[model samples]
Target chain A: MTSQFPSTDDVILGPGDDAAVVAAPDGRTVATTDLLVEGRHFRREWSTARDVGHRAVAQNYADVVAMGARPTGLLIGFAAPADLPLAWAEEFTAGVREECALAGGAVVGGDMVGSDTLTIAVTALGDLEGRAPVRRDGARAGDVVAYTGHLGLSAAGLALLERGVDGPADCLSEHRRPSPPYAAGPEAAVLGATAMLDISDGLVQDLGHICRASGVRVDLESDALRPEPALLEAVRVLGAPAGNAVAAARRLMAVGGEDHALAAVFPPETGLPEHWHAVGVVAEAPRGSEEVPEHPVTLDGDVVERGGWDHFRRE
Target chain B: MTSQFPSTDDVILGPGDDAAVVAAPDGRTVATTDLLVEGRHFRREWSTARDVGHRAVAQNYADVVAMGARPTGLLIGFAAPADLPLAWAEEFTAGVREECALAGGAVVGGDMVGSDTLTIAVTALGDLEGRAPVRRDGARAGDVVAYTGHLGLSAAGLALLERGVDGPADCLSEHRRPSPPYAAGPEAAVLGATAMLDISDGLVQDLGHICRASGVRVDLESDALRPEPALLEAVRVLGAPAGNAVAAARRLMAVGGEDHALAAVFPPETGLPEHWHAVGVVAEAPRGSEEVPEHPVTLDGDVVERGGWDHFRRE
Candidate 1:
């Protein structure tokens, strides 16, 4: 699609200049950035250039939505080997354009450089429409913790792709391109979310951020999760330990990242969306607490291990 | 120094959420980004983490200043091997903070990720107090071209470092940390510059950008350059070709990138600062000519080969 604003008109000053000036509607702007490396973030064999671009935009946009903001524009930096096909670059831009459309934003500008491997760094800008920013430090004791997006779906999809599971093609696709519940973040804020975060890491890990920031503890009820049954099928297909499967799903719900799900703690009285589930409640930390509980999710009436991905350690 | 605003107060929302909201003065923001890779941009053996941080901030902030904007904040993304030292990260942050202070800005937020090699991506934000952004396309025929900031110094230092020629340690240090004429950008803008650009990609190459964009041609009188005598000393020490010294200097002026100098074409009658010199004049492209001149700058009354760095074929 053509740019929403003419190249000359949309940008008060275009890309060749030092900095770009974009129209800020509400006198406030929201900004976030993410970097994607070639082999580490994506392998050409597993993902097309378009897939890479889509994933990049989706993840960053997820962050904006999680803040209850609407994405406005994006600036991308791409580094690639000299030998890479020019077509790949064109396709990548197209993917960025498509994802920006999905996220209600535009690809305003970017820089391209030569590298031995391909890397993409993306910065997203957003608008809050004068609403107070919802932060992770505001969850209080007695708040209801709710999640508005897929829980273990991305993790399950990743497992299926890794183990070569054959049941559902869509699961593998989801692993490549996550469909975050973008609208849910702002909706949660509008509904009085006290604290919020994007579940890019894992459900538990991200909620843990809210817990630590807000100085509260979180308790999750496994039965309340809607995606458990679907995840179990993949667990069974992989013939993995049932405990590991449950832990993976729980950890993802609790720690699995990259889904870009928006999890928030709101006043207990606040109503939640149809897809959102009240998996837990925020409470004051217990006295003499030495460690945060890993498996806060109770399965079959017992707590289990919730091991999720960690950037510095093997998953 | 502690943050100017409390984490909760200044950030409105700290980093845990999807995006961040910082107060934008007068509802206008200046944004620019740059990516620096480990080997491509700098070698660990040649510079410390702190030096890398300073260089990264300097180049990006130069862009902001090049636009006649006052930098206010920066967001950095770092990708490094998992085993990298924590102290190195801290030092890097300190360098960024130091340079931000120099530019009158703060390090607002950033992201860290694990990668096979180190890469630092910086996005700088600035505020222009109601001044129009100076662009490269604004020059017209008969505009006088002038430069503020050091030229050929970094290139001279690079030649010494590349050839392993020992010199006063300051030359190498200058190469590692260029002191851009930060205030000159807006100064030129306020002085009624017709068009302006940062002299990062060598004098001739950068001016070429202005010429190509402004639909004009540039003619440079090299005898007017002030640093020629000093550069000749470094050239002699490096044992570069004797007949090629002038050509080399012109090439360095033409295509040399990364000096971060400010170059602008001003109205012919405009007075310039004492340090600023009349390097060239912009003129209409010659009739029936599809190609620009082979050498945009005439060195000592002769045309010379102007070659500068291109990432794809720099070496």
Candidate 2:
């Protein structure tokens, strides 16, 4: 069943057992782990316990889905000081359940421990339905690159929060709790995606991972990278100068991370899914090109330097 | 292949990929998580990082094996201060690998993050090989209970450590790195175990879990629970009074924790496994008795108080 609506719960075993059992009829499991530290990954001043919980589950589930699998079960390792309020933990658990519901995943088990710092370590599992995983190394020359999901909203939201300014609610909210494009993952896999990845470390940087792994170069079509109306509205409302909205959007798409968007490569002739927009094309090494091109990712015909979040980040 | 020595590697994917894939030929997965904190679970002054790593994996792997599953994969979420020495991490990793080899598990994936306090959260997965899990609730009134592996050594070693005294090599080493009865789990399952558990919180306390879950009372034969020579040696070396050494070992068997031994309930007609020693018998409540008995666990017809490890431990 699709996560767009409710589906049957997939728990084979819940908490209170020595361990949890999850059904894996495909004879394989797609698993990923994500660790979030309080001050480094989220700040209590900026996000609620519920928001932190949702963010943690969303990112790890996105990774499983990106591998062309259906997210099924989640196990959490949560730690906080003895003084942490019970209400905070309850809210955090509620958020974890909420996201698991949306992702069609079961909260099967977890480990709770006491520590000086608040920490969350999550392990997510997914079923692949007997399909070959859409690995990052599967992209080929002449493949077309497309991405589905919001691009600039999260970056703009972070900017608004740092400046203490008001922008579109969607903008600020995206930064607080990421809503990854869950359905796009399996949909791309079904459509014969050649390669896939979840964009957590920004678009260009993550796509570079696809490029280096597949030994190909990807060139973005600048015309297709236009800013959506909401992003432009946020840029203008945040007091950006006239004519800078487009550049702001470009930077957000290029370097701002944590949107948890889904990006995939498909054979050029394969019909693109309705929600996927073709924004780039993969290229082979030129006649004399080396094993790995120095610049494997580009905007139009120019190269983009990889930089830290400071390039477009507010914090 | 058995983990008594080397066998085939089980890795399907390492940490380099966005997510890891693992074989689940049994069409089901047994998963468990354990979170260990710095001071609450281990102290760096007392444990090398390698010891901490082994302790962490041993406990989690034991849980899976307790459910009649074969350990297959491990995922670690490690967090520590920015200034922690790199050598600590390497040694910790080596310890993880060593234990995984002994338990027949692969380090499939992990998340490394930075936090103020050192925290290691682990998720271990196991394959059941199409066998039904030996749940704690499956025991019948006439079942027999048996256990294999060292029981009181860990508690006795902890006692010696607290007093800055030395004990037998195996005694102190058991406290440092738990050597769980890995093979006894599946071996018990094949021998038709009805209920099973890992003894992490001392023998009587853990067996009480099975008694409560299965709605039957267990009576341990005091003859089988006599202190072993090494435990007595530990008590004597820790400077216990002559006659008190036996009392000390008996206390360790009753209340010491973290020995990670396998305890299982078997049908009355089943022959006990090679290394297993029959130590107890399951008893149904008398006619018209309440659902659960007031005292579900007894030693030699006498009710034994379930006390904290502090009763026999120094820390």
Candidate 3:
């Protein structure tokens, strides 16, 4: 039967066929998969099906970008109750298409199944276009650490949402739809990034992943990482629930998850790209026989104790 | 951290990396995804976690093969409760690796999340090696229809399982683990098969999908589609509660789901590959002035009325 699904340039073969065929110019494919379950990664009362679909694609797309690759296609698996409205499914697909278009990608194929609770799984495929993949283990001591995109906005959004703050709450919207720095990854790679990762977890916590992978310590300058004025305004709008808005903003910036910003380490002599913020520096781990530092991530010489979200934790 | 996971040659890159890199020699990638949820697709009391994992991969792998491609890599997303035993997760991954190896593929990457119930989402990738994909719309009126792999075994096994039939039950075992004929797909394509598809939703029902897509009628001969003795024996073991065991076997062979068997249409001049059973023929739909046949599939010249499993049905 003829399909009503939209088609795009990247998808040589689209949905309705047994499988999709997509172009891979570089002779290699970069792929990643992520799953989001209702009540765990999202809540129906809090997120519309459209919001959930956008969020799922946004996060998985970030992973491919973190590898310094351009997304080519997406394969999605959605399991929802049979009683779910057809309108919800349509809107969800629209959201998926919207996000894919934003990344210059296409939804090539998908599967729908009946389940008791809603679940969405997305797999993104990308092409490196002849560039080497930027891995988390390539960072070296003395490299500069930089980031692109907003940091603690999503976390502040969540706080405002929880507090039932009235009127326009940009943080709440940011929480529902994370716009990751898609182009920044490939740009960083072109600019000779030593190592890279996406900040799905908080800044300090995600940088710790880089440190552990590269066997180096990352030191953030507190002055450089001070919460942005927008986040401080959000704190003011929330009426300073934490009693000290600046400290609360700092804590949120360090430990809140799901921002999906791009973070990378570059050689000292490399020219930093526009909009890239230099926030930290990579250092060698303590030598043998020397005491290990209390933290792999230090802010202005102070060890950070709070970490990012752990799904396995009992809350 | 060092991985305890097993490795394979097909994997250019493996888990724990942000994303995986797999070879695509033909400059194109064939991809498909499927989702299986607990209680909906499998019962924990009936199938082990390992069995569930194998079934999930087998089904998704069949789709890639149906497109006349060689399976390359798989990306899996699993969500389950935090209280789930670590052993369950390990066994599940082992099952995935085992099935992928059988298909000459590898488990390249995956994601894990905490949820109330178990859900497995798998996306399979493949390389066509420069051959044109055999789509379901390419079947012609004079082409011969063929199928490879077990037909009614899984359904008969389900029946025996539901009846609590004791004694040797190979059909029950088959239901727990599907083994699709992966090699036959590329072979069929090489032999110039016209159109192809995998029989995950019974013989007649799935053939109807091909018929609708190709805009042609498909005719199955009863003599050519006789159920294997093993499946008939299963019907006998269940005591033919619905009456004639032979008739029950015939219906099961025509309407059972989840078999993961490969079916295709080939030109009459093309020599049929070994292991591919010729079971039917393609025919033209009624003329322009005439009304289309009520059924796209015909059994021994009679229209089939019993449909296959529909997940969205209230029943």
Candidate 4:
């Protein structure tokens, strides 16, 4: 009201009370949030402001898709240094708008604050169109675990970048920007997936979430992983320790995060699309097992000793 | 899901999707978000981690109330250095929990990441039951402007602290932690407030927002403001620049922000609570005015310039 901006009737109570009532015409709403920090979550040297913005929106929207919801709107809170370039901010906003459009959503409102470093926080809202949310705790003992979208590629690319290895541009591109299988989440839900999640943090770690939530053990077959060859080739080219690379790739496929691929557990006999590969199966925990009740799937017939990324532990 | 956490049915879809869906039994949800950055927003020396947590929740929740909604839940995204004490993090969460209880909400979810400095982002959700939102774009000519909650105390306290003027403990408390009139927001909405907003930036600037949005001009009668001898005494003690304490009070009541006071425009004949004071009137722009419109109300028998905090141009 301080400026000459035209007021809209839709904002019944704009900037005044306990909550802004956005008209949810469909009667159901979906909500997800993501936070991006300087250095830790992103590096200005590695990614441009636009790239950071796109990455931020893509990851959060992937979560919305994982929930089987159609993203509708987003609210952003941006914190940055007072001296930051105004153009950076503008381009960042443009990136968000572009990514939101890709995810079929609009940026509704945002707050900007001056901080010492750049940080972007985004909360996305969606509409379910009346479908029940598919949860991670619904996988049964006999469910077949399948995945949609690329795996190991992000981890392989990350390894290549970290080791300063030059590779085909594809590897670096994969590390810089991830293309999540956005539509596959709701599609899986409609396909009768009992339980599903987005593969961020690596396959093993993410699937461990489903297993622990569903109280089941999982057995993975290594032969089914087709991306291993490409990953191995990248690992060989990097000349870095192949132990961690092989282990990390398989581990990331099992345990690494940020790729944001869709993974779901469906009935054993459920038909899957070509993009989805049968990677594992759920099983009852062995009686009186000394290990954790939910067992992790093994790679190349070897049981993975570690779980996914733990914030408390240094990588 | 990786940790030993309880599974709740309330979290229909947790942590995997672009957005999470929760039950909204009332068919309406209230929402607001805020960003608090280190150095710019708060100095660690001036506030403890717990204080930061409390302030973050307090200010955002106040916005929710300003919308006339009941706080229900909150999701927080915290970015801090890895070396930040575990105890500090615990205490910070405790503070969030304490404020949530005070505002009648729960800390439903959050994201934590490592950053060079601490930053907190909070998104609060509320339920409106079934009431219309009171907006700032409804004030009409001849409407009486009133305010609930303390005004200028924060600015006064801040000025004292900035000048290193030793004051009574309560003055520092006001500067450190503001107690916004949370209930007044919904109360004003129910009372049929034509235009309303929380006085966050400053009374004058915020009112200017309402005026611009509602297409009206506001004029404050200086004599209507009560005596502020305490502020005068403090200003004198600090050897601050000379200004009418009453005029400053009037200006603060008009422009200064961060007090989070609720100001509402009502029909001139409407009855107000004992604590509420009628300070101004809403009217059309003055006649024969090229810049400002006709019908501008005379403040203290003269026109007063509008001023307040602007983040981009902060002093």
Candidate 5:
């Protein structure tokens, strides 16, 4: 563990000691944790050790970034059987280093233990840079909902993989190692985003969480929430039926998870960040709608009924 | 997850947000992560879910405290099968809350995922309160080695459990939930201690780490390092021959892990803090030895060869 860490400026103390001390110059630290289990989160046959490592760091770092914080350090824990190869550990460590460098951070400490199966857990820390955190409960009526990064590529990719269809490498990689819009989070915060979160569990499902927290309803404009070209191509290759492509695309965009996109609500007058696209508008719930259905997210006047992944439930 | 977090002053932002923002008033944060896997680090039949949770938090918090920092927040990740009882999750969470409160911290955020078996990972954050962190490499030749809290009770407890012996409940509880001497870390720092660490991997084994890092040898006085009465009683009940109790006690003290006792090197002239006992002294390595004696820990002029737990290897 001592030799695994490379000295970085923000790390005052590194892995050899009992704990690591990281610089939190803004007097606060943004922290989050994630777990990726073999066969459940990723199959060993489908993902390389490097892909697993990169994906773990990317998803955890996305949470910190969505809070408008710049990541500074990571602490990881791995549990694997004793028979696991040392080369796998080395490759995984390299992947962690690569992703942290890409996100402008470092792995200062970690722990390893023995288990029956492979498991990786990462906790990422970030510096807020003197700004108040952009929380999920600050969305309000008339706030414009915007997002940055790929929307449905990950879901489409998974769909293709599930069907055993030979697909584009980029699409499969999207499912393996997502490329979150890392810089856009703090940028949105700087551009006066009122509320923000990472879209890890499908856009609609995660947005519903924000709606419940903020007590506001969100109506998405289907025309504005278009799927990416990769997702469109995947839908074409899926070939559900003639004229079914549009519905398939819409379904993928609405309920696909693991995109790691940044979703934020900004005042109507505030300009959206460069990479962000406006997709919806926040509104008050209808006062007396006993007959009308009540839902947090709607697309072009229709409720999105599909649910995202729930760890404890089957589809 | 939102309802699970009670508002705490140190947690500026809690579970509902993308990530938790915790106050780190001294411009630095201490961090550590640990993983507890079912049937490896813990066994479902032997430990209650609550006991697993408490032990996980206790061990990780000890690492941060060993750095002379006061724990402020925790971020946890748990992976278990979908069929696992909800009551177990609730009990584990309650255990986390209880331990955090005991350590003067709170659970700021957490994530849950599905897996074949139970795995719990925790990342603890701490505040230094303007003091420089005490590291492992600061020990010097003439420094008095001191320790606080139980040294062999955990091992003795494990022995009783393994043999199915009906022993004292306190010893069994010590194995299930270790109560680390959390306060002694910052106290040692404030009292001008040179170096510090938690003895989680047995006395001689962990002391060897301090020796290798500080480039000094440690000589432990057998009388000063004797086991407590409880451990002696446990040894008596084990019925190793009448003359072997002392050896049994010494073996337990030298190789017991999970005690979570704070070990430090303080200047001889400085007064020892309350609850701390002087047990050894740091000394220069012997000269003209080609092999460097192949060991850094000497117990009553003999090198201790009994090994502690190694995660990736069998004993």
Candidate 6:
């Protein structure tokens, strides 16, 4: 299905035959799959066909980049209703093409099918370039938690989109077409990150994942998490992010989803990538404390409750 | 998402992180994707969740094998309605695990999402073991076309199921959970096979793909393609494969879908792997033919019109 596209240097064999052969020079491949369903992940009314495609590819690419790998190619599975206009597909794939190029990858292959609902399944592949993967289980007790990129702009955008109010163009555009920090992945790996992941399910919830896997607690510095101005404004407009502007700003940054920021832990005193800023500190649970903390993630001294998009329950 | 599965030998990093790291020792990876949509690819009334999972994995595995590669891992994207039974999801992934084991691979990672329609997107990855991929464009004029599995059992089973008639259990079971000749893939490359692919759409249409890519014509020997007794019986009961029983059997063999048989072109006089049967011979188009054959596939020197399942056109 990818035969129409010109072949790239990394593609040893392009699509048209039974399968595509991509160069994996490092002798290992980093692979991840993501699903985007119409109405659930994106609404046609809220996003242009190209925006939908960009968001889909961006989400999958972040997964690969978070693994400290260089993107190689993608195997996409697109299913849609028959009545969809041909222009929609063209624009969507065009978005896929452009976004993939940004990641130094190609659309290696794909399957197109028909269904009652529009759906997209993207499997992003990457080459690790011979580095040991930065896993969630590798964090040390004294590591510092840092994040690169916005924390809640996507959530802010969603708030505005949901209320049919136009405010900050940055938030609105980002929610429609997210731009991930793809380069930060390998840079963090080189900088000796102990644990890392893409922030898709909000900073608090995602940090909790790293803490649970690494057997530590991630305590955020509330001062460092001062809500971004755009997000604060979006929260003010909604008046419902948390029932009040200040609380809503904090909650929006805490649990807003789909920003695809890189959240990573580095050894104490280690220098981080320029764009990365310290957000929290990783520590063992208080010694001799009768039980583990209720929440793996905490802000200042208080546990943050879990709140994020629930995919299945939303149905 | 695949963290619960026991780690396999080929996996360097298991799922739990943003992505999976799979061993690709040959410096390149073979990739292919296939989508199975509800109502279009399978009917829940006719197939168990396990059956659906098996069929989906089988099709993707065939594509990788056709590239003369050894299966390494699979990344699956599964989406279904919120009301779906939890047992259904469990049984479905169980089937994915078991089927991937057949090709010496593991379920490395996957994404689960909510959608109005049940959809599955499977991407199979493979290691070529350092051999050149067996592409369709490599067939020589004197090569003999061969096959290494049943060609029409799945199609026949579909016919029987569509009519709600009692017929061959082998056909029915195979249609639900195909057991492709995976070993034949690497073995064919070792035996100097020039071109190969899995017969997903049909022998005729798929071979036509090879013909156009290789710039050669494949002329079949009628006697070599005698209809299988089970397929013939199924055709007799259905009375719809074609107008007449014999013609129906021939059409079923020529245009059947989902059988996923391995078809290859081997140099003349090359000894084939055990169980492979020679069915046709590759040849150049006759001198001064004004145009390419309308259909690259021919039977007894006559063209066979195209017939195969089309994914998008169904809508």
* Candidate 2 per-residue C-alpha lDDT over A46-73 given as tens digits, one digit per residue, 9 for 90 to 100: 8888898789899999999999999988
lDDT of 4 by residue, B212-252 (tens): 66777888777776635554554445443466445554554
Q: How displaced is residue A214 in candidate 1, in Å?
A: 1.0
Cα distance off (Å), candidate 6, residue A44: 0.5
Docking class of 3: medium
Task: Give the TM-score of chain A, superposed on the true chain A, for all candidates in the order listed.
Answer: 0.86, 0.92, 0.91, 0.84, 0.93, 0.92
Listed models, DockQ each: 0.52, 0.84, 0.78, 0.44, 0.83, 0.85
TM-score of chain A of 6: 0.92
Candidate maximizing DockQ: 6
Off by over 4 Å in 6: A1-6, A240-248, A287-292, A307-315, B1-6, B239-247, B287-291, B306-315
| Per-residue lDDT of model 1, residues A1-315, tens digit only | 123222422245546566787555566668888889877877787778887878999998888888888777677777778899988887777788777767787666666776775778888777776787888778888898888777766766776655554744555566678778877877887898898888877776677778766667777777666555666565556554656666544554655566677888889898787777888887676642344455433334455345543311323
Q: Write the per-residue lDDT of candidate 3 for residues A199-237, one digit (tens) a residue.
A: 887888888878888888888886676777777777667
Highest lDDT scorer: 6
Query: After superposition, which runs of candidate 1 have C-alpha atoms over 4 Å from their true positions?
Result: A1-11, A228-232, A240-252, A287-304, A308-315, B1-17, B83-87, B168-170, B228-232, B240-251, B287-304, B308-315
lDDT of 6 by residue, B242-268 (tens): 446666676777778688899999999
Tens-place lDDT digits, model 3, residues B52-154 = 8789889999999999999998888888888888888887877887787788887888888887778899999999989999898888888999999988888
Between the candidate structures 1 and 3, which one is better when assessed by DockQ? 3
- The TM-score of predicted model 1 comes to 0.87
Using lDDT as the measure, name the better of candidate 1 and candidate 4.
1
Work out how many backbone clashes candidate 2 has: 0
Q: What is the Cα-based TM-score of model 5?
A: 0.94
* Chain B TM-score for all candidates, comma-separated: 0.86, 0.92, 0.92, 0.83, 0.93, 0.92
